[model samples]
Target: MSTKKISIGSKPTAKPVQPSADEWVEHRGNGNGPEPMKRLTIDIPESLHRTIKAQCAMRGTKIADEVRELLLQKYVKS
Candidate 1:
């Protein structure tokens, strides 16, 4: 005979928690620069996004391509 325990009202979940803006900025600069950004809906500042778009245009590439290239150069290479 064997006895096992497996009773719970609700199993614990490991949902990710969001950080405050200040924490986010600091955390992003911690050599890793925030985890890979998801390709979902986001509310980036218009000015920042516009600047990125301009850079993409100057580089003759799409915004996503520019971002990917920058990430590889800045993060992966390091």
Candidate 2:
């Protein structure tokens, strides 16, 4: 019996594909009157995420809506 050698090396990665700004806006708009909303992402603890999700479900609300309201209250000041 002969032993075979194994080669392990980093694989070449393909560049991430991103949509053009016009494409992104068109896709997001979908004829919805040109909403100018921007997307954001945040990292949170898993437990906190679960709690917020559960509370929103119970209140028949959306996580985005809750976050948007909190942001508006804090910064918009109107």
Q: What is the lDDT of residue 4 in candidate 1?
A: 100
Per-prediction RMSD in angstroms? 12.6, 12.5
In model 1, the runs with Cα more than 4 Å from the true position are 1-43
Summarize candidate 2's per-residue lDDT along 12-70 as a digit string, tens digits: 79889999998896787677596578899999999999999999999999999999999
Largest TM-score belongs to which candidate?
2
Give the Cα error of residue 70 in candidate 1, in Å.
1.3
Residue 54, candidate 1: Cα error in Å is 2.2
**Weakest 10 consecutive residues of candidate 2 by summed lDDT:** 28-37
Candidate 1 local lDDT, 3-71, one digit each (tens):
999977787798888898999977775685665565735689999999988887888889877667777
Native-to-model Cα distance after best TM-score fit, residue 46 in candidate 2, in Å = 0.3
Work out the TM-score per prediction.
0.38, 0.57
